[model samples]
Target: MSATDPPPKRRASIGARRNPASQAAILAAARAVLAEQGYSGFSIDAVSRRAGAGKPTIYRWWKSRAELLIEVYAAEKGALRAATTGNLAEDLTAYTAALWDFWRDTPSGRTFRALVAEAQHDETALEALRGKFLPERLQDVRALFGAAVARGEIAAAEVEMRLALYVGFNWYYVLTDRLVDGRAAIPAAMRLVAASLRD
Candidate 1:
């Protein structure tokens, strides 16, 4: 208790000494399993095996496959990043391109497709996909357009329809494999959306 003696040095709290290398390994393994086996075949046991970590370790970090999948999707999608270049058209074009690429080019897109198929029969999976994943992307889009409203390029009242137009067009192209030229379609789509909202 002497003043000269350092007051009991505080020890790191329990579970505070997480191994970043281990965590990265688990995430990387999870992504690999997701890509190889897909959402339908994905399992904690498989991820643990692929990760060289035990079930306890995976459970400590994520309680459910859905939880882990959220992280996987976020890591892959870069969290659906949005842009605000002040020019609404350009911003929308960029956002659209990013979204398109994420859905078209990434393994996460295949995982998402599998999730969609699973959701048709699994209520819990459907809830997670609908409640968490879709809304996150939608909110990002909303923010992008909200900026347009603030700048007076788009009417505040038209934000909803504007969002629908952009989403619908993108979905149509992705689903139907029509108009593979996103470069041409993106700018044309932006102009159409702008014309609709022009005051």
Candidate 2:
């Protein structure tokens, strides 16, 4: 405690301080890494280097790589609005076409595909997808179907099945990388769906 004694260095904080700039940097870096390296090569170390932040800093904010990946996917995906054409068939076709284009042309698609792949082996990611992401997405689809029911274009009872069919159809194309080729089938599919609903 002597005056001549060197002052002890302040202990480093127990965990990384939640710096907005740092977090934004990390997220931006994560997006870049995912876009460039994809999910297979994405890692804490890679993001740490890209963001100029340390591993501990990244880990302090995101518990795992899968968690970070999910965040990146969610942030990039944002909110998608369902098309509201008066005709149910037109609305469904437009909505599906927009979705296919979004997936095929944007980083969000790859990010989501990675998230789906990660969820297969990571429970945290799976929970996020099943419990959070998927539900949010389904709501948009539900709105579209709800509108059809209100218009009497489809019975209320048919909404659930249509939702499942619509989601499954889009997911199949996304996972198979068939969006471009599948575009042609959308009109036929929507016509069939609309016909069934009307019947």
Q: Write the per-residue lDDT of candidate 1 for residues 53-163, one digit (tens) a residue.
A: 767767776756876787788788876778788887887888888777777677776566556666689887777777887777688778878887888787889888887
Error of 2 at 32 (Å): 0.9
lDDT of 2 by residue, 109-149 (tens): 66677677778998988887887678866776688778888
Taking all chains together, the TM-score of candidate 1 against the true structure is 0.72
Quote the RMSD, in angstroms, for model 1.
10.0
Task: Report residue 122 deviation for candidate 2 (angstroms).
Answer: 3.2
Would you list the C-alpha lDDT of every candidate in the order shown? 0.73, 0.75
Model 1 residue 198 CA deviation in Å: 5.8
Once superposed on the true structure, which residue ranges of model 2 sit more than 4 Å away at CA? 1-19, 52-63, 196-199
Clash numbers, per candidate = 0, 0
